[model samples]
Target: MKRVLLSAFSLLMCMSASAGVTFNPDKVKAVYIVRFANFIHWPQESSLKQINYCVIGNNQVTNLLESILVQHQVRNIPVVFRQVNNQEELDDCQLVYLTPESCRLGELKIDRLGLVTVSDERAFSESMGMVEFREKSGRIVPVINVDNVAKNNITIRSQLLRISKIISTPQGVEHD
Candidate 1:
């Protein structure tokens, strides 16, 4: 299983080697988001027949997500893309992408239950987002906030955690 995940991770990274046009950063992030669906499990009660992947930023990632509607999926559910203008609308989203500005507010009104919040801010992993992307050695590395993820009632598979740069240490807090 670890080998398969590692291979998949390698494939995803290879698929984004070229810069925008050939390999867009937003598209890369979009791919990561889609890949996330494969490993991040929401509670059964919170899982939906249709998952709305939203973005608070008006960036290329938004456009990239649209392309995955045809390439990726979650169980029997359909994957979709949406532009969110406010937190209230976030309730309908399973995954929400926040820009630096949106994450900066630090007072996201969106409910944490079953939601995967991703950001690109430096302190995003330490503060608000469950997952974050940062440039490291010329590559975009993902950092996860394990504590916060559980706080929001989201479950992350260990395989994903093994591959990600988890920012949150075990706090002696148990998770279900």
Candidate 2:
């Protein structure tokens, strides 16, 4: 099993390299968001035609995400990119990538809409987002606030939870 998995990963890396995608932080961040979408489950009644991958205040990452989406699908659902401009535009987004400048849009409204928020912005998971990507020792670490995920009625598979840094509370206080 391990050998098969390793082989598949190697083949994927080779394909990525051949496709002109060199390993970089921006590309990694975009890939991470795409992978996260596969591991999270939205509410059952919220039918999806395509996964709406939204980005705010960053076009470079958005472009990178667009490239990755061309080769992948979230749970076999087609992904469409949306470069969002404001909070109101996020209503139908299933996944969102935010920068610190656009972090203000990572509000309770996102949770209510069942959006899986991922960001590299510091303290993003502690504030209102579900996942924050932090760089540690030359690797990007995903910090996840499972509480926020649950509040949004989304279920992240335990396999993903096991690999992430889990925090149950935000700001050292439990949610009311």
Q: Rate the local accuracy (lDDT) of all candidates.
A: 0.72, 0.72
TM-score to native of every candidate shown: 0.79, 0.78
**lDDT per residue, candidate 2, 112-167, as tens digits?**
74788888888888878889987765456678887888888889888778767888
Clashing pairs for model 2 are none
- Could you tell me how far off, in angstroms, the CA of residue 158 lies in candidate 2 after the best superposition? 1.5
Writing each residue's lDDT as its tens digit, candidate 1 over 56-171 gives 87667767667555534566667778888877888888888888877767567754778888878677767667888877755677788888888888888887787678766354
Looking at model 1, the pairs that clash are none
RMSD of each: 5.3, 5.8
Residue 134 miss distance in model 1 (angstroms): 1.0
Q: Which has the greatest lDDT? A: 1
